[model samples]
Target chain A: MISIKNLSFAYKKKPVFDGLNLQFKAGHVYGLLGKNGTGKSSLLRNIAGLLYPQNGSITVNGFTPFERLPVFLEDVFMVPEEFYLPDISVPDFIKHYAPFYPRFNSEKFRNYIAVFEIPADSTLQNMSYGQKKKVLISFALATNARILLMDEPTNGLDIMSKSQFRKILAEALDEEQCIIISTHQVKDLENLIDRITIIDEGKILFDENVETITKKLSFRFAYDAEDVAAAIYSESSLIGNVIVAPNIDGDEGKLDLELLYKAIITNSEKITKLFQQ
Target chain B: MNQFFSLKRFTLLVLKHWADNKKRYGLSVLAFIGLLITWFVFTMLTGFDNIPMGKAVQQITFFLSLFAVGTFYASQYFRDLGSRSKGINFLLVPASAFEKLLCSLLYSVVLFFIVFTTAFYLIDVLMVAIANSLPGTEKLAGKPNVINVFKVIILRFNSDSTINFLLFFFSVQSAFLLGSVYFEKYSFIKTIICGFVAGFILFCMMYFFYEHLLPNGGFHKGFLTSFRVHVDGVNDHLVQVPRWIGEVFRFLIMYGIAPFLWIVTYFRLKEKQV
Candidate 1:
């Protein structure tokens, strides 16, 4: 679990997070969405203790994240947007690095690597970027850290690797784990993240549980002019004008993340008010 | 299991560092040996007639190789921190800052000296043996046992001065290590520039204060020298720095300088950000 309160972070005079408050609880996969330079990855770095907040504090799993004590670090792992794997074989990397995490499951690591299809003896530098990302993802999951922070994890992955990543992440997660993934590719995370938090202009524009979102908001096509006017957010697709409207009834439909993202971004005030109510 | 300083963790960190850099390090060792052998042979062929293959040449070679390789190693040990890829990997490793800093000291200070000394002697002993094996060259060169060569080099700078010299080497090496952390790129060159600029400024300040401002303080190189100031129509006044102050300066040079630089290096590393 992570808690950030009144966190103000900036780059020199350029501010990023201005008194932003956010929390991530265990047993949920969090999708962090934002436009470029909106502080999504910066938020993840703050939670991972990589970057210190200028004001307030970040608490991860009951410990101050920035202290970076071995015990604190053992329970937290971060896959940076731009990451590095040493110039060593995958097995050698694991051999040299895995001991730091007491709960690291070597078996799980091997299984994840098997699913990713990376060669055991191959040097990491020889692998493609996507391949290296897969290796890093596998290693991160195997660490069994209570909190896992990933930035643009699916950026370099092929279509199939992305799907494989979603599957392994879902399978590897436990109730005690909290995974916060910052990415612009929402489709890669469909049916994966349970909670969505969208940030814009150094503030959390939208944060809600996917289940609660589906329960309160209806994502469907507008039937006519009245429906189009009544809809909170809508866009014209090949079939019709798809809309996101308030679901007053108990009817439940599939959550279209991309559409939901647009709805929240456009009608952020109304949507936020609805959630508050 | 100790968080701050664990012997097990330290050992693991050292091994991990080695594993990460063994290829480059091993190759550097080989290259160092080649360079040493080549330089020795070249110097013997070219300069033997003028300089003579005596204790002086041997001492010069030892000190030259020692400093060249030592500074290079110190400058490069933390060079990985310059790039984000390597820097991130290094910083994120689950080791305390103390452990990480200690690991660097172990490699740059201890292991570098031992390994470089061993390599130098190995090459020197073999080369000296080969040179002596020839009929006429036996008298030309000293016998090539590593211990004898060490004695010759050690005798050149007496033991006390040699210890001070090594301490001074550490002070210089510590500055380079700090530079490796200080500058993101071109750490070696940047460190040299910083040192040169700092030296220039210090020299200027010393000239101004000691020569121009300190009551006619033209440096009289004596234990307790007095300066006579022509105080503009007044009687000439004598100003003397006490012997204790001079001893203080000597003590600082002998003992305080390296530790002070090391502390600065530690704080610099501790404050290092990605």
Candidate 2:
């Protein structure tokens, strides 16, 4: 579990995040939704204790992350968008890094690597970017950390690898562990993330469960724009129009992430009010 | 158990770094050996006597060893800052700031001293042995006494002598550490510039206050008079401060600069972007 209170950060005199407060609970996968330059990465880094906020404090599992106590560090892991693995082979990295993570499951790591098709003998530096990310992600999961922070994890992966990534992530989830993933590609995390947290202008706009959202709003196709009545938000495609309408009929429909994202950003107040109702 | 785990983590980190850069470490060792050979050849070609060779070798080795240590420390520190992979991996490890600081300090100070001193002694002994074996090298007959050399080295760090050395060492390290943490880009150069700028600014402030703002301030006169008397006495060949006091004052000054530098570095680190 993680809690951030009134967090504000600045670069030089320019503010990046201000008065941001949010809490995350364990046992669910969280999709951190945001636009470019929305301080998504910065927020992840702050939670990871890699970057210190100019104001506010972040606590992970009741320990201040910035303090970076062993207890806090042992239970948390962050996988960034870009990473480098030393020239050492996978085995060498394991030999050197496994001791630091008390719960490190070497067997699981080996299994995951095999599943991911990462060559054990290949030097990490020699691998492709996606491969390197896979190794890091696999290793991160193997650590059995209580909390995991991932930033743009599927940025450079091929479509197959992205699905493979989702499968691996889904399989890795447990009741005791929480994973917070920040990415612009909501489609990548569709059906995988249980909760969604949207950030814009350095502030969290909404934090709602997928089930709650689907129950309150219905995503349906309308043949004509006129058929969509008092919808929260709608977008037109070649076939028809997709609209988010109030669940007044108490209809439970599949949540449309793309439309929900648009509604949250374009008409956030209306969406927030609808959710409140 | 936790302490043991922490130690294991530290060792793991060091081993990982070594494994990753084994080639670089090997090259550094090879370069040092080459330097040793060059020193021996130069002495032989110049026909320098044993005493001169000993003295020159001692001074050169001392400096060379220091340079080696400084280069390794600076390069590793800066390289980590510049490296995205290494930096992220390092930060990911669940260690306290104190533990991280201790590890860095150990690498810069304790490990460096051990490596440099061992290399210095080994190279010195080998060079001396070769010199003694050469024709017309009778002047190099007397071998360096190991026990005496060690005693000299140990005595140099006595309470009286160690103060100044420690002060200077800490000041330099603090400057480097601050630089490593402050600038996300071009940290090495920025550190140097920041140090110079800080020193210059302090100098100017002192000069202004003493020379223009308060031309006849009694505080300045008293301080300068005491400083002058101290310097004059040390060189007068008559009255001098006791050796112990001199050593202690030297150490105090060196260490005094460390906390201030560390405080600044800490603030800079807190504001780090990455």
Candidate 3:
């Protein structure tokens, strides 16, 4: 579990977060959505204790993250957007790094790497970027850390690897773990993330569960001009107007994350009002 | 299981650090040995007639290379902290700051000294033997003895110049280590510049205080503790601290500087953000 209260953080003169309060609980994968410079990675870094908050506090599993106690660190693993692995073989990396985590399962690591199709004896430096990222992801998951903070985890992955990433991530989750992924590629996380926290301008624009989002909003193409005009957020496509409007029907529609993200970002007030209601 | 200083965690950290950097370390040591051989061979060919190949050449080579290599090694120890990805990899390792700092001290101070001294002696012995075996050189001058590095003297600056230089080396090396963590880029050069600027500022401050701020008194016997003042007619008054206090201060200056810098380095590491 992580709790952030009135957190204010900045990089030198440029302010990132001001009085931002957020909470992440175990057992759910949180998709942190935001524009390029909206502090999505910064938020994840703050939670991981890589970046210190200028004001207020962040408590992860009853410990101040900035203290970076071994106990706290062993339970939290971060897959940074830009990551570095030592110029060593996979087995050597695991041999040296795995002991640091008490819950590390070597078998699970091997399984994840197998799923990712990365060679066990391959040297990390000699591998391609995607291969390296897969190795890092596999290692991160196998650490079995309670809190896994991933930033742009799918950035370098091929189409198949991205799906493999989603599969392994879904399989890796448990009731005692929390995974917060900050990424711009929302489509890759279609059914993987259970909760969505959209941030814009250092503030939480929308925070909702996938089930609730599907129930509250409808994502569909509208051929009717009136429906397109009345929709909360609509984009004109060649075939029809893709509309994200209030889901008035009782039947739950599938959640379209990309469309939902756009609807929230474009017409946040109406969408937020609908969610509130 | 102790969080702050777990022996298991420390061992793992040391092992992990070694595994991560063993290749680079191996290459660096090899390069150092190669450079030493080249320098010693050059010195033998050019300076054998003028410079004594025994204590003087060995001693000078030992100290000069020690300072140059030692400080550069310490500066590079934490250079990974300069980059965001590497810094995150470093800091997020499951070890306390104390353990990390202790591991750094182990490599930069203890291990570096052992390896450097071994390499120096290895080259020193070979070079000395080659110089002594040279045709007609042994008869023209006394045999060139291989210097026992521990016993070599430099200008009689202290009872044991080796020990003095070793302590000074640690102090300067520790500063460079701190600078490696403190500055993001060009840490070695920045630390040297900062050291020069700080030394100059301290010199000016001391000169101004002694000459203008304080009464007309000049420091004499030992570090700032003994001063002589001149009255118009009376014998120049000599003021000095108690011998015990002066001895303590002296001991601290010689031994405390490295650990002092180490403490600063530790705190800076704790405060380091990436």
Instruction: Return whichever of 2 and 3 wins on TM-score.
Output: 3
As for candidate 2, its clashing pairs are: B163-B251, B164-B251, B167-B254, B167-B255
Ranking by TM-score: 3, 1, 2
- Candidate 3 Cα outliers beyond 4 Å, as residue runs: B48-52, B214-217, B232-234
Give the Cα error of residue B233 in candidate 2, in Å: 15
The digit string of per-residue lDDT tens for model 2 on A228-274 reads 75777888888888898778777677877878899889999998888
Mind sharing the TM-score for model 2? 0.81
Which run of 10 residues does model 2 chain A get worst, by summed lDDT? A223-232
Q: What tens digits encode model 1's per-residue C-alpha lDDT throughout A133-221?
A: 99999999999999999999999999889989999998998999999999889999988999999999998898889989999899998
Better of 2 and 3 by lDDT: 3
Listed per candidate, the RMSD to the true structure in angstroms reads 3.2, 5.4, 1.4
Per-residue lDDT tens digits for candidate 3, residues B1-274, read 7888999999999999999999999999899999988877777777644643656667778899999999999999899999989999999999999999999999999999999999888877887778778877656546787777777676476777777877888999999999999999999999999999999999999999888986676788786889888676377788888999998898998999999999999889988898
For each candidate in the order shown, give its overall lDDT on alpha carbons.
0.83, 0.74, 0.90
List, residue by residue over B1-274, the lDDT tens digit for candidate 2: 4732467666666776578677776787678768866866786678554542465456555554564455436435635655665677766776545456556656665676577667767877776676556665565456433222332332343644333444465577667766676556676667677779989998999888667764332342223222222234355222345667766765567566767766675555434446
If ranked by lDDT, best first, what sequence of candidates would result? Answer: 3, 1, 2
Model 3 residue B122 CA deviation in Å: 0.8
Q: What proportion of the true contacts does each candidate reproduce?
A: 0.46, 0.69, 0.83
Off-target runs (Cα >4 Å) in candidate 1 are B48-53, B134-159, B216-248
* lDDT per residue (tens digit) for residues A1-277 in model 3: 8999999999999999999988999999999999999999898888888888999999999999989999999999999998899999999999999999999999999999999999899999999999999999999999999999999999999999999999999899999999999988999998899999999998889989888988888899999999999999989889989999899895699888999998888889898899998
Give the number of the best model, judged by lDDT.
3
